[model samples]
Target: MERLQKILAGAGVASRRKCEELIQSGRVQVNGETVTELGTKADPAADVITVDGKTVGAQKKMYIVFNKPKGVITSASDPQGRKIVTDYLKGINERLYPVGRLDYDTEGLLLLTNDGEFAHLLTHPKHHVAKTYLATVKGVPHGTALDKLKNGIMLEDGMTAPAEVEYYDIDPEEKHATISITIYEGRNRQVRRMFEAIQHPVTKLKRISFGDLYLGNLKRGLYRHLTKEEVEGLIKLARTAGKPGNRPTPKKDK
Candidate 1:
């Protein structure tokens, strides 16, 4: 028997965490019985499971990389009537959700997948998946600003983890200078906040890479599935990081 949340996530029901919430809210039924427990288990090969009275089973897994455009929320829906990332995935039959998130104004590479276990591993704080971004700030930062970001900076939540920063020398004649930043943490508005702390507000931010994945020439709002090698490498990394018995934490929106 496996945890119900993991099974649901693997089955493309939702992320493991969100599945747990469904259970708690009395939306999930297992073997014809409502299961409201957080760590409930079920046999995927045998037991019948349902969410909101709909049968639940593993669906075809999909791994898509999207070059997200600015102004789209990284969510399945928005009650405020705003456009969400799902709007860009018009033809996909599988119900996939974004792995982590990009702020509404930020744009670039975003992963969408129905493989909840993989999503958990990629987004979990302990795994430390590095994300690289190209940022254009209002003013060019000096050595001190860069050093502060590398060491750590104080935020409202607490001190942030150290980040990797490098200047991007594009055209010297360009009005705005570009900088590359790599961070392991995924705190809300982290990249922007870090620069703001040093008096250099970010004008534009685009994530160029996430973990081993790169945004290779994909234009804005386009998406593609991850290559087999990339998927395997991610699986290996998750296993190496000790993801214990395939039991994933319940999914919550990041």
Candidate 2:
């Protein structure tokens, strides 16, 4: 049996994650019964599956990298009717969804795809691919502050994993700085909130890289298909990340 979302993704409905939303929203029917749980599964060969009353069929997978512009919602659609990431994908025929999300005001690299397994591989917790960002903040961080940020900062949600933080530029007045940070986790508003925890709220934030993929001169609000090499590199990185860690050390001598 295949997972409901996986089956939908392969049928070109959307990415696996987006398919989960369909399930949760009570729009997915399997053999004429609604399945709302994420773990629901069925044999696509036998089960008559439909999404929002439309039957699904095998479809080609698609991938692209979007240079998301500020003020656009990262979601496929917004209840408020604000422009969303999907609005920018007017010319693309296949249904695709953002791999992860960038905040409405945050600008930079965003990945979109209809490949469910590929999306799962990239966003899985064990495959927390490093993401690099450039952030303009309100104050220059002292060594102590920078150290705390690098080691880990305690946020209301939890302790952040270790990160790499450095000053990219500091104003002569020492009042503001452009900081570069690389982090593995992609919690909601994490970078902005991390700085806020350190008393240097971010004024501007832009992701420059995601694993092997780079924003690289893509004009704002425009997108491009990823090169074959870049896609291969991400698969390689995810494979490496998903490997089991070396077994725990043998019990030490007493």
Candidate 3:
């Protein structure tokens, strides 16, 4: 028997942490009895598990790489009726949610999948999966500003970890520059905020790569299934990086 949250996560209900919240909130029922204990375990094959009165079982896992267009929400659905990432996936029958988030005004590579465990493994802060972004900012920052980003930046939340910054070309007339920044954290609007901290607010942003997956000319609003090798590689990377002593110390502002 496996933990109920694990079963629910494996069945695509939500991430393991979210599933725990559902259980504690009394939204999860097993064999017609409400269970609120985090330690509760059940045999998925034999037990009748229902979340919010809807039965859940093992589903055929699907992994997709999407090139999200700007102005599209990264959620499964939006109450405001704005366009969502799933709106691009018209024919896909499986219920998939984005593994992480991209801002509504930022476009780039995003992953959608029904495998909640996979989502948690990659997104949990301890994993430190690297994500690279190409940011076009308003002004050309000097070496000192770029060094601030490379070492760390103090944001609203706190001090950011050291990032990999690649200085690219600048448009002399436009007073703008395109720089590539890679970060391990998935904080909300992190890249944009990082540039803003350096007095170079991002005018445009696009995620170029996530871990082993590259966006590579995938047109905006289009998506494709992940190959077996790509999925395995990502899982291996996350697992390896999550091991003890593998995580990086968040750089303090000096």
Per-residue lDDT of 123 in model 2: 84
| lDDT tens readout by residue for model 1, 104-125 | 9999999999998889888888
Which structure among the candidates has the greatest lDDT? 3
> Against the hidden reference, what TM-scores do the models get?
0.89, 0.83, 0.92
**Which 10-residue window in model 2 sums to the lowest lDDT?**
244-253
Q: Please, what is the whole-model Cα lDDT of each candidate in the order they appear?
A: 0.84, 0.84, 0.88
Q: Residues 1-254, candidate 2, lDDT per residue (tens digit)?
A: 99898898877787677788999999999888989999888998888999989888777777899999989999877999999988888799887888888998899999998887787888887886878888899988787998888888999999998887777778999889988888888799999999999999999998888886778878889998888888889888887873222212121112
TM-score ranking of the models: 3, 1, 2
- Regions of model 1 farther than 4 Å from truth: 170-175, 239-254
Q: Candidate 3: list runs displaced more than 4 Å.
A: 172-174, 242-254
**RMSD for each of the candidates:** 6.5, 7.9, 5.2
Positional deviation of residue 181's Cα in model 3 after best superposition, in angstroms: 0.4
Candidate 1 whole-model C-alpha lDDT, 0 to 1:
0.84
Candidate 3 lDDT at 80 equals: 98
